[model samples]
Target: MTEVAGSSNSNNLLLEQFKDICAVDTEIARRFLTESNWNLEAAVHLYFHANDPEAIQNDDNARNEHEIRRRNVANPRNEAPANQNAVVRRSSESQLDTWGAWFRALLALPFRLAYFSLREIFLFIYALFGGNALAITNPREDLQKFLTAIANYPNSERINWFNGTYNEVLNEAKSSVRFLLVYLHNPSHQSTETFLDKVLFNKIFSDFVRDNNIIMWGTDVRTNEGYKVATSLHELTYPCLSLICLRENRMACVLRINGMHEITPVLTALQTALAENQRFLNAILHERAQRELDNRLRREQEQEYQIALEQDRAKLNERRRLESERQDAERLAREEEENLLIKKQHLAEIRERLRAELTNELAVKGGETIRISVRFPSGAKFDKIFGVDDSLEKLFNSVLVHATCPDDFSLVSSYPRVHLQCAPDWYREFSSVEENFGGTKTFRQAGLENSLVVLVRDNDA
Candidate 1:
């Protein structure tokens, strides 16, 4: 019981709200509110307000009268006694007219039947005599011909029509992110000429349609294609206009106007549809922009990654090259050190052989002895006893071992003015001794058998 009472209270509040918005009879407002699922706001929006703001504010009486009629139509059983009485009077008058028509038809039935029969017979005779049969008309072909005729007309050319199939136009509209405006024409419609001349061809209307990003498709109902579209849209009137838009991946009619020839009504309907669906269009544009931005950012990141990868590869190659060069240099240095050691060992062996030979030769008993005198650059003189078989290198060694400045001086024979070079080792023996005066000559062979004097002088001097 409490739930029921609460529901009643909600209903009462909605009805009161509707009444405040509509300024009409309470019952009429309640009916409209109920029709809109007891939503006061929707009822006011759909039934109370007019498309034009000025009309909504100034046409209270007209709106109330229309609402009253609508309310009666919605709930005839709940109409007032005066309306019921009027309906009863009209019902009686209709019954009387129906009987009178039946009586008159009963009297004229034979004559009418005979007239129709005679007309059929005459049509058959004319068809047989004229040597022509009634041609079966193709609605699609008729529609095409009609469209061709309209296309050739000077006035019809002003309105731009999409030159493609209906599906093509719809697909284009979806891809281009625009609205599709479909105009269904009927050449037989009485108001078609007026509508095309006064409203559709108006400069303002044409410009608006042309400037806006809208796809306009038009077809005549006489064609197979047009008939299919008309049937699908449930269009009951000729010269119908429908604004189709994509919503949530489906095409839906946003606005429809039928049998309207006036410029104001046509323009108003078009404007209202565009204004209401602008939000959906904006959402599509925003989503596309966001997707493009994301794609751009992803591309940039990929390019940066590619650059970084190449740089890393180049660095790795450089590091490997440097390591290879370092290994080569180390190998070369080791080889050079080994070669130097080998040369030193060979030189030592030659020097030891020379020393042993000289010692053996000098060990012979009663061997000839020579007195050799060597002088240093420091005004010092020394005398030594040396065997005749001894080499000049031995005497030079004795001088070098005792001299204070051995490296700076060369030994010279005073009478012959010959300089004797000192050999440091056997590896350089020939280069150290004096050339042109017998490089391998011994001290005795150089005519220094008895006593010889040798002087030391600076090598540079």
Candidate 2:
């Protein structure tokens, strides 16, 4: 029974693999990158492993189990496996559960390790301002082409699928950062536009009104959503406005154009968006400038008041100095007068005793005085330059987040479209797991998807 269950699970896994490789469309992966809110790393992982059989199987099992538990909790017959006579089904289910757990755990290890390694490398490159956007391409075709190109490059090493160098991926990412262009076509003629009967113009008009930005200027036709017969086509273009505004909050207009239609509208639409954003940005800068000007004026007023107070202080000091000098002069005159009076009295006393030998002597000594001035010690000036504050790292991180893109593209980098959120405790766990798997690229090459999640979660925290 166990063997049968194992066979069924294996078959299911194989089928899922086939569908991922063959059946699922590639465009969906690109769409998900923008919609999923996953940073570039996570998006790349999702795109690469979007079709993995094991992932699908696990998701299916989880959903199925939840549904069964919710619906069958009151049914005793369904709850007990022992009461069932279905030996093959019971064995297969048990085998699937046990094997799936082992497989998931084994598969997750390499992914986790790769995540850490790649992020470390990526962060280093980002420090150099050399990171680029992830290009949305047909994975199978693009991967093969990229590999072929790498093989032909002079002094390039062979790309190891299981243990590919992070340098190689970095180079590839830089070179392949192109936007995916989507063009819509008419459903019936496979052309740009067609005349449809009984179409509600109001519906089309309402869609345009809700969308705010209009790509189709001067066209009054509205309510085209419920066409009797409509067709569409897809093509690649350089001016992918939809991709550009993928992360923006504002709604963008979607225009219908046929393959044979002129490229003028596409160019015009992009030009309009550019002009609008430029005007908005300029206005913001102007407002900031005015605010700065007002602040400067206020500072100048404060400085003027300070200068006036300093002048008043100087005048008061001058008056004090003159008064002190006058007081010292008066005191010196009084002392000299008292000394003269004493001298005269002493002379009179000496003259009265004429019989005795009268003698008077005045002694004076020459003396020099030297004065030495010393300055008191203070803490070293500009102390913050040398580890005075432990929060320097935090300050630098804040700067990094807020700094504008430098003029030098070589010094400009985009933040990862995806940011990981995880707890500090999770990081400790990841660190220990990484220690055992260090010094190898086995983790990344094993699977980019799992690696993306594990690595991003660890680093982001």
Candidate 3:
């Protein structure tokens, strides 16, 4: 009975494996596997070949016949009368399907047993050398499935089981300088069930592992990771436990439990292992904490230095901007001053040339002399002799070229204070000095007699 049960289990295992490889539904895998007389190799080859044109034609023909039969059953008018040959053919096909099912049931067990035995032999030979005979394609998939199973187990959620590859969990524990407790579980072992029920699934043990910060990573011995762990630790006993700690830069095993034991012995061993390694773990943790603190301080100092450097740069940039503005203002002031000086020099040259021309103009010969005394608003008086032929314009020019003359002024008789410009010229009304005596060429023509006094009033003043 036990042998039969084992064979049945192995056959189910093979069926699941076949389903995974072909990525097909259970019914479809069973159909093909049964048609191949439960020969996995023949079933797989036929599955691949089933996609060909001839096989597809056959499948389509089968579906068409099934559809026709369904339609004839639904519509009585489409039903055809059965013949003896058709009945015989249908009975033959039915018998063949039944025989195929019986063939699978009978043959699958022995095939699965033979295959399992051979695989185990190879696995044992390879495991003896600390290596896996079969490589797992998706290691993480297996790990995730194992984690899910443990999490769903009764009272197993409280236990800390690292959900990663064995090496990953080991590296993490070593990096954190924590004590690593590894368990290699054997699902087929009789005592494994007891160990899980009483020891690993207990709340007290869970709390103990958590409070001590112990990392527990476990795997099934039948899995790729567990087999590797079993080989590396050189321990094959079911429900094995190995306690490891970082010592001299390596994860060295300090304690190991070879077989399933009661909760007390496991707990006592764990407590003893943690006690022995407490001092070493503390020293490593203290050194790591000190290093982290130093790094944090260095980072803070670097941040402050960067801030100070930025402030200095901003100040330098502001100084440069202010200096640039100051230089611009100074340059503009210098240019304005130079331009003003040049304009004044040019005006002085023009005035000097006008004075020399007026001097020669006033010295006209062989004409009646007219003495004109000019009185400025500043109480300054000047008597200038001029010929009758010397135009009134010449008289005005003599005052204009004087050093003390105003830029704009009008002339009038001092006695009556009557100005000759009663109605100012249209264009030159704003410039009285330049147009005071327009159209009157000589003093007599202007109705001015000799010894006349003219008052020069400064318009701007």
The number of the candidate with the highest TM-score is 3
Total clashes, candidate 3? 0
User: Weakest 10 consecutive residues, lDDT, candidate 1?
Assistant: 85-94
CA deviation > 4 Å runs, candidate 1? 1-150, 163-165, 185-192, 220-237, 301-320, 335-461
Across 50-146, the per-residue lDDT of candidate 1 in tens digits comes to: 2111222324543553344433323233233322221111111212124544655466466556655765687699888984643445654544665
lDDT digits (tens) for residues 20-93 of candidate 2: 32222223332333333423455445534332222323344434433332232222332223322111111122
- What shift in Å separates residue 134 of candidate 3 from its native position after superposition? 3.1
Using lDDT as the measure, name the better of candidate 1 and candidate 2.
1
Backbone steric clashes in candidate 1, count: 0
The order by descending TM-score is: 3, 1, 2
TM-score against truth, every candidate: 0.45, 0.26, 0.53
Worst 10 residues of 2 by lDDT: 405-414
Structure candidate 1, residue pairs in collision: none
Top candidate, metric lDDT: 3
Q: Which of the predicted structures, 2 or 3, would earn the higher lDDT when compared with the native? A: 3
